[model samples]
Target: MVSQEKKIKVVLAQFPLETHNRGIITVAGMLRDAGMEVVLMGNARAEQIIKVAVQEFADVVGISSYCGGELALGDELLTMAEREGIRDHTVFILGGIFPPKDAPKLKEIGFSATFPPSATREEITSSIKSAIAARSLG
Candidate 1:
């Protein structure tokens, strides 16, 4: 759990081709209610997401994917973060339409967590909180 002493900041984005913003919006509200700051990037390019994350001084970058291309995009996002020198500073998470079988691949690609379609609000919020706490410590 993230202590109330600091407000965690998260940047939420979806894979470029995905237009479904409802989940992202709902997650944003949940994060805010949990006392974290959130910025939703609504279907953005990897570079754009990274730029905003850096600008916002984000603690976590949560990306939602629904088109089965999360593995490639997740790898690209991690590579970009490494190149930009923010790999260790930011935690990356993937949510929406992910299969249980692909969770390991997502983690190997540097995603901090992967939430399947049925993930509850508590699970998502707790994951974000945990990531933020871990990042702050290390």
Candidate 2:
């Protein structure tokens, strides 16, 4: 009998005020095509995203920011996740328009990875899969 790997469950969200969503929408479709299950939450607040992540038992929590203030949003989301007790198992990733210098800051704030606009589809999917796998091992 062939054994199938469990599908990775991901919750994708954007800050409630963020209006640039085309990239995130495309990413959601890409993740789904990569055999992962994705729950896309449009214009969601940090708390809402955390609630959904918990309810969905999501392996990954992805946030997209295009209207700026990614650092603050990322920090807020991580704080909320930590408060909700899901910080240990869930992989957090950030994507969208942000200063290149902010990537390390985001990672330091607890995002597992950050993707710039130039990131390829393969890179995003592979990194997410790798992060989830690493988290499981850890």
Candidate 3:
């Protein structure tokens, strides 16, 4: 029914359910401008996010959490990724309101990339490229 286009399918779970969500819309636009398929899942259920990611066969997942719960949620997300068997192929990126000091902690939990707040679009793009490059090398 629909056309199959080759684009970087992304699910943006970046932003609290109560916020205006303009930031995520902007970020999604940027990724779209870069020729990547972007899906904005504002305040979606965790299981739904996981289900959609698995069903869509998304190439990347972008989570945005700025609150204190990111630590716990991040860990749970990694666990969900593993359960879905997309841990290796999907590009796992976390963005928004992140503290740089915790990068190691997220990295340790199998996150392929982390984009803290104030990070430029180029930085995020570069991270994805780097992940692709690294995957190719290994």
Candidate 4:
């Protein structure tokens, strides 16, 4: 586990208007257990999530999309983050019910990582840590 001083601060949100929150809630628990500070912003719009990320000084911003609009949502969030000037320091990740093909598209849209429902707890935590590390290095 990381020490308190080095804990990765993450702000997690569900895509705007999305109702399937169980996956993100579970991920919040997993991240906390992994020693990262997680702020779960349930069902917030892209703008609200970006505001919270800035307020929290988040190292990572994660969105879970159970709905089919992952591409649009991801683009919107990235645009907002860029506007808020957190795009460089923040690692953006997306998860939940998206097509396998959309994963690459999401990445192209500025998500640092993408996860399907099949992603394991270890994979999620490890990927988040790695992304944070890479961001710091760059």
Q: Identify the leading candidate in terms of TM-score.
A: 2
lDDT of 1 by residue, 23-130 (tens): 788888887887888898898899999999988888899988877888888888899899888989788998888677899999888888888877777898888778
Query: Per-residue lDDT for 4 in model 3?
Result: 82
lDDT of candidate model 2 versus the reference: 0.92
TM-score of 3: 0.85
Per-residue accuracy of model 2 over 1-138 as CA lDDT, tens digit each: 453988899999899999899999999999998889999998899999999999999999998888788898788999999999999999999999898899899989999999998888899999998898898899
RMSD of each: 2.3, 1.4, 3.8, 1.4
lDDT of 3 by residue, 1-138 (tens): 454866678888853453546557777888888778888888865667888899888888888776656667778877887897887888888777767788888889877887766778888877887786676576
Off by over 4 Å in 4: 1-5
Worst 10 residues of 2 by lDDT: 1-10
Clash pairs (backbone) in predicted model 4: none
Each model's TM-score?
Answer: 0.91, 0.96, 0.85, 0.95
The best candidate in terms of lDDT: 2
Write the candidate numbers in order of decreasing TM-score.
2, 4, 1, 3
lDDT of 2 at 70: 89
